[model samples]
Target: MGAGIAAAGLSAVNWEKMLQIAASWIISPVLGGIIAAGFLWFIKVKIIYRDNKITAAKTWVPVLVGIMGGVFTSYLVLKGFKTLIKLNFSTALSVGFVAGVAIWLVMIPIVRGQAKGLENRNKSLKKLFSIPLIASAALLSFAHGANDVANAVGPLAAIVQATKSGDYGSAVTIPLWVMVIGAAGISFGLFLFGPKLIRVVGSQITKLNPMRAYCVALSAAVTVIVASWLGLPVSSTHIAVGAVFGVPKLIRVVGSQITKLNPMRAYCVALSAAVTVIVASWLGLPVSSTHIAVGAVFGVGFFREWDAVRRARRQRSEIVAPLAMPKEERRRRKLVRRSHVMTILAAWIITVPAAALLSAAIFWIIQLSMR
Candidate 1:
């Protein structure tokens, strides 16, 4: 959409915003996975692994529910209800805290009531999580609807507003019909097409009982909350899908794959990446810190390789001894992993064109339907 607008010589395309959204595509899912995995780990340690699983759940589930209530409330207030009221972070947090405590106090008896007759088995424990899981899933869907409906309708609204007013670069006013169309389309599509995807994400990827499913749902919601706090516009669908699937170790591109990173080398990469991004942003360049950081790591790795080769030659000239480093050690000493470089390059190469083609196809379909 941005590309099409730019091609038409419209000033509506915000390149910096596009770059930030692209960066979020990388950052958000990873954070979702990490948060989900961590939540799963916590549940395993605190509840699942305990001898008295029911007792453990009865003790902790209320607290978790309260936290979720708080986070969800804050997210809805700050992101979902933005037009109604503008809230500062401190005010939002305070509101969240009060809501959380209220939820905690209310849920204590409810959870206790639910858990009262349950057995100490894992199956019984799963039963305890069903309510929270269902609630979390509903909340997640609500958040997705709120965020993505705007995205779906925004361009259409802009085009309508622009065509009606003959101003292509003005603030867009979304009509009531546009909102209804976006909502109805999403609803019908999801109703007709969502089950297959639900099955795939809910079960095909991994077995999920209420307990595990709750963790994933809550993790996704919490991740979006954190991203909101950090002021990043992330895809809720991406976050939920990532929570259901797994997190990738893509950050290793700069931290490890390019070279062995000690504290000093890691610090250098971080500082250089930060400075490069700061400067680029100040200059209004759409530069990605991810790319800059990876390049810095490669630079450091190549310098280390050159230094090692030079030292090896100097040692050889001083004394013609047998190979000081074993062949295996020498092989291990290769700084950069070529496979990592190639894989990263291949992904970078395909990402833009693939996304553009998909966007074009969807836009075409929408245009045809409208006509």
Candidate 2:
């Protein structure tokens, strides 16, 4: 009689808890998206328009692709991992981390070459635009922090519920530390390794005016925010990359230098990255947004001779100055490059597992301590 009574109580508690978990899963992303969208809109109308610039036409195309792509990729990947591994959160986290590292190693060289080629082709923008770029980067970072952090925290919330109620359906307040760690890890990834990818996005995939880049960034942020508000999981990386490509295409369509535009190459890269994410997720590997974005940029860069053509147009004197560097300085530069490569590799390898391990360990310890 006592056992029957206890089981009935447990079931009742679990049912109530499920409602809470469902509510949270629905609300959190919406809140995150609202915040992202509001900030992006503010930047667009107040800052971007103040400069008398407009985003390229058909900008929505890439923004839509990114939103759809991110949502689809994330859903499929998460679902596949659960189906294949049947592992606990801890094991899955570690596995995902290893997979992310592997993807990074393969992507870096390709992205670097693309960045260099893009730089070679485009005349560097005047320094005046630096402030706008920095601001845009901050906006990108904020959107990333809001959305991606949710990805890290979502499982933790589930684990906490499982531990506390001995059920999977409870909702618990997310701790400050978890938020801090996720934000920090993402910031570290952006600050230390983001510049390379940024250069690729900013310079390599397409030459963007500050106004154009701002529009692209604004469009991506806005789209993500809207999706998030609707509880949609979207890819900020895809949106940003798409925005970058969209501008060049727009310029071409209006009978501007269409010959220089390479929509086929851009589309190919984007498709490959999407396919890669799907494959990786299916294999239960957690891939990085950074990696996918970088790979896409690299793919577009490798198939063209635009760089060689651009180099031919520059003054010969400018090319010779870099070669005149002192041997020691050149050696130092090489060392810096190698170190950057290694650091990026380490971050990629460690992120998923580290987050998972941290989450699991925290949950386990809390359970023990509470008991």
On residues 24-104, what C-alpha lDDT tens digit does candidate 2 reach at each position?
322322332232233233333443334322221112222323332343334323443555745654454455455545544
Candidate 1 error regions (>4 Å): 2-6, 9-15, 80-86, 225-232, 235-352, 358-371
* Winning candidate number (lDDT): 1
TM-score of each: 0.63, 0.35
The regions of model 2 sitting more than 4 angstroms off are: 1-130, 170-172, 235-371
> Each model's C-alpha lDDT?
0.55, 0.37
Tens digits of per-residue lDDT, candidate 1, 1-371, equal 43475345346456777677667545433434344444555665788779998888888878777777776676656665778999986787788888989998998888889998888877787666766766666655554455456556877998898889988775777899999998997798677546654443333222345554555455444544444345444432322222332224333332345455432233223223222322232222333333433444454455455556767767786887645666875676676677766655555545555555666677667768998
Q: What is the RMSD, in Å, between candidate 1 and the native fold over all Cα?
A: 13.2
Error of 1 at 205 (Å): 1.4
Clashing residue pairs in candidate 2 are none
Query: How many clashing pairs per prediction, in order?
Result: 0, 0
Whole-model lDDT, model 2: 0.37
